[model samples]
Target: MRRLMKLGAFALVLGLLWSCQDSNEGQQPQLEEVPDEVLAQVANLGFNADEVKMYDGVLFIEGDIRITLDQLEKMSPSDGLPVEEHYHTDNLVTGTPRTINVYVQNMPQKYVDATDIAIDRYNDESLNLTFNRVSSSGQADITIRASPWYYYWFGILGSAGFPENGDPYGTILMTRGYYDNVSNINGLATTIAHEMGHCIGFRHTDYMDRSYSCGGSPDDEGDGGVGANHIPGTPTGPSANSWMLACGSPEGDRPFTADDKTALGYVY
Candidate 1:
């Protein structure tokens, strides 16, 4: 999660996200304890490299991205975030007319409906891949679940991973308990859509320097070994209204901009 924001209540950043996982276990076992050497390795691949945390056996970086040592061990680092608008990762769902099954569970009914709206946002477009909301996990190419209870207390809205092996990232974790506190169901839908973007390999529109939106020193979250290649037709520079910006405000609803549609069509 790059960060989240409170709905006009002093703007508590609910969060932003990206994720990865692997079988290379015990690379660092202590919960909540991340070693400097590991941080160095993570930094080498191009991430924030600051305040990396271990929670529930997963490495959470840049607020909500989950990455494992296995991916770091295997991936070849790519160039920094490009000075462009929408971008996609090197990995993608390669086949034509692909159906990405999405399942949402353990969340509110409003959220469930919002998921549909998010799905609709994409389905309305004419991309090679289509997102279908499945009723069960067995049929899902991507599953969205409520994050751990503590995540709500931690101000995390949602998290997801980039694509790998020509397949979409498998899961999304949305924070629980903020359903009512955060007004605007469409804003929530925006967050869900953004996570879906990640699972399908989209990077933050402001990836060149997250601080452009999140407000900090210009942090190039790096390629993190997975690759962040710029889309050919998107406008060059940060898109303030792009749904995939590194951080977002709680008050606004971020539908995909024209450039965003171009990026989706270009990559898919």
Candidate 2:
């Protein structure tokens, strides 16, 4: 009788294992379909159909390019030939002498000061592009806000949206804890400036070869019929001093290099 009881216990354990496996198989998640409009926009920007994927409601293209459905809907149609490795959205803010009013919200005093310093750097150049601080969020053209927690799982410093269809570019989102933990104030300021470059439609200087700054294999975002454009007069190779470099060093403080100024002058 004891021998029979041991065999019965083993059989019951095997039955439970099979039940769990069946449950897991039934619970498998399905892939969400990419919206037609979103796919068209991505294709227009040069991404192939296979390169674009929709997962968990977020659209991923070229591996690193993350877009929301709302943002995809807001983008304007693409135009112009690829120019310097600097990437840009087809949508540019209107008016030659554009006055972009920036509203700072929810950031600590230090970050606000850092943002002001960054704005001053651009204004000091006396280019056609100008950024002014405004007290009211409703009256502002660009809104800068700090995230309560780190949102970029990849350790990115910050991110900004591009100018789209008549919208005042997009909001700038900065990582709160990352900035708070940094000892160098200038490096923090550089991060703000880099994201600002994106706000104005500037892609990373090392967009073609991220290894220049990121120190890894050359990261080709992807081969879209439309790749990064080369701004007239900008260098063809890697630039160390560019404010728009993809990676930043905690000890490094970067101002606009000559090429960066040239690119800015050419665009704005």
Best by TM-score: 1
lDDT of 1 by residue, 129-156 (tens): 8899989889998898876654543445
Question: Candidate 2, residue 234: CA error in Å?
Answer: 1.3
Residue pairs whose backbone atoms clash in candidate 2: 46-224, 83-229, 83-230, 84-229, 84-230, 84-231
Cα deviation of 41, candidate 1, in Å:
2.6
Candidate 2 Cα errors over 4 Å, as ranges? 1-66, 73-90, 148-156, 227-229
Query: Candidate 2 local accuracy as lDDT?
Result: 0.58
Q: Return the TM-score for each candidate structure.
A: 0.81, 0.72
Worst 10 residues of 2 by lDDT: 1-10
lDDT tens string, model 2, 77-154? 344322222444345666758788888887777777877878998898888879888888987887878632213232
Q: Provide the global lDDT of candidate 1 against the true structure.
A: 0.67
